[model samples]
Target: MNVFEVRGGKKLQGEIVPQGAKNEALQIISAVLLTPEEVTINNIPDILDVNLLIELLSEMNVKVNRTSRSTCIFKADDVNIDYLHSPEFKKKSGRLRGSVMLAGAMLARYKKAFIPKPGGDKIGRRRLDTHVIGFQKLGTQLDYNQEDGFFHLTAEELKGTYMLLDEPSVTGTANIVMAATMATGTTTIYNAACEPYLQQLCKMLNRMGAKISGIGSNLLVIEGVDYLGGTTHAMLPDMIEVGSFIGLAAMTKGDITIKNAGINDLGIIPEKFRQLGIAMDFKGDDIHIPSQDSYTIQKYLDGGVLTIYDHPWPGFTPDLLSIVLVTAIQAHGSVLIHQKMFESRLFFVDKLIEMGAQIILCDPHRAVVIGLEREHQLRGITMSSPDIRAGVALLIAALSAEGKSTIQNIEQIDRGYQNIDTRLQALGADIKRVAI
Candidate 1:
């Protein structure tokens, strides 16, 4: 395992560019399987999860050409369908939750797909009910093999139909949309997830000759197409990283400029940080956050404590709630963080409590943070990363603390952020990756 030894109390200053959207890369890369023609993707983030998905594609005999670090050309012309049944395939796909998306693309083109019990951050109960039910609604027959722990889906011919999703699950919606792309009729999906990543998928599919409407809304209409061709697509900058950088700048009193931040697509992220009294300026497509000695949290209009909660797109993202919580530790007032989407995400606050922050763990879903206002600095301690988001949150806390901190299980952090330690080092952060 690799751990990060972060020596805290150093202010960062430099310009850093956010990588391509990790969420969008998962969906878009899977979409290449819908066509046998060459599909070129640009701005791909060099992260663990996305790279694993690409490796899975390569193992399936997709011709992959890496013309640049951030660009790849994939042609699924000679995909080996038999590889899906291989033990190697199962072992690898089991480690990545994004592997579930391959099912929809495979089913759309080959009329069959296999999905192992997917693994990802153990944040909560992430069920496959949404994906399975949506596929069944699209004329796919599902079977489960208990011995191998895989879901088998087969369809002689997919026929599109209307579906009202139980929840606006992002990956579920992406899977169903891909499966419906080559079906026989019109498919209408209501209550669908309209996050920017999903919209990017729809637009990319349209460029590839799939007919999809309602790009930025809950209602999506996809007309079945006979064939899809190849197209080049670029990903938007990762909004989660942008939000994390904003929080990092505030917490450590750093002057950082995030280049090509894709600010318009960020959707309430900057405003949410601003509510915590973090000041920023927009420079073209960049976000400039200056050094701050202290920031104050905003209260509600009625004098109630400000409550930030996660909702669907156009609302605050659940991924950044941890960043918000950690950033508030050094702020001037109190705020309530309600992580409605995942029950266990707030559990990491216990580590912050050990770092001398005033936090109340109201429950599994909510945390109340009384900002220390820089009156007392947090003292670093040994910790372990629980998930991707929480790992970055802990790294942020460690960076702003008073001494050296050792963070174990940094693989979770590498799964999302691209070359995080090297990038932070360029900004004058005293962090090093050590193998243990």
Candidate 2:
């Protein structure tokens, strides 16, 4: 592994072009297995999760070639479905939640899929019920041994119908969309996750000869076809990282600009940041972040103290709660950070507290951040990254601290952000990647 040794207190400046969305790239790569033809993907992120997904694809007999640093061509003309059930596959699946999506892809193409317990941030119970339930609606029979953490699902032909998901589970929504691609009839999915990543999945499927309407809305209408042909598609930019960099530039009192952000697709992320009194000038797709000495947290509607929280799509993403929480520490006023998703995600505030941040960990799920502003700058301290978003949050925190800090468990950060250290270094950030 890799560790980031950052000497904080320097304002990061310059520009960065974000790579493709990690979440989007993961699902699109898996979608290649649905057709026995060459599929080209552009703007693929250079990250661990993408690499792992490519490894899984290779195991399935897909001929994957790295055409460029940020592009790949996948041909699954001779895929072997049994590879999806291997122990190596199972072990690798636990690395991230994206692995769970493979079940739907395998079941759609081979009419059978074997999957082990999926892994991701242990924020709370990341339920698979929505996924299994959706598959069952398409005539899939699910068999499993809970003791061994393996699942086997099979069906002869999938017949789609109207289905309401138990909840708007993001991965579950993506799974159903993948499985519904080649089903026998039309599939209507209500309460679907219309997040940007899922929208990218729909676009890729459409290019692959799957008929899907309602790309960015809750109700998805998918007309399953007999076969899906391969095609080339470009993935979207990472919205979470765009949000992260926005917060980073603000908290450190720096001037920076993000190059070529997919501004039209950001949805409510910019507005969410604006709620905390962070705004920027839009130069086409790039956001110009100016140096600000302080930020005043906006009051809540109906006149109360300010509070920032996370919800499902079109609302703020839970993955960015940590970033938002840490950024709140540098604003001019205090704000309540309510993380409505996971139980243990906010516990890392103690680490920031150790670095002299004024944070009240109200409970397992909430933290009230008292902004330090210019009164106190964080003192550098060694910390371990707990999860993907949290790890980057820690990195952002360390970047603004007053001394040298060593951050371990960088693989957690690597799973999400593509070439994070390299990108940060380009922005004049004093960060170096090295072995611990």
- How does each model score on lDDT? 0.95, 0.87
Please report, as a residue range, the 10-residue window in candidate 2 with the lowest summed lDDT: 118-127
Kindly list the per-residue Cα lDDT of model 2 for residues 38-148, writing each as its tens digit. Answer: 999999899888888888888778899998968999998898877777777888888867877788888888899877877877566777899999999999999886766
Per residue, candidate 1 scores C-alpha lDDT tens digits across 7-28 of 9999999999999999999999
Give the count of colliding residue pairs in each prediction.
0, 0
Regions more than 4 Å wrong, model 2: 146-148
TM-score of 1: 0.99
Output the worst ten-in-a-row residue range by lDDT, candidate 1.
Answer: 143-152
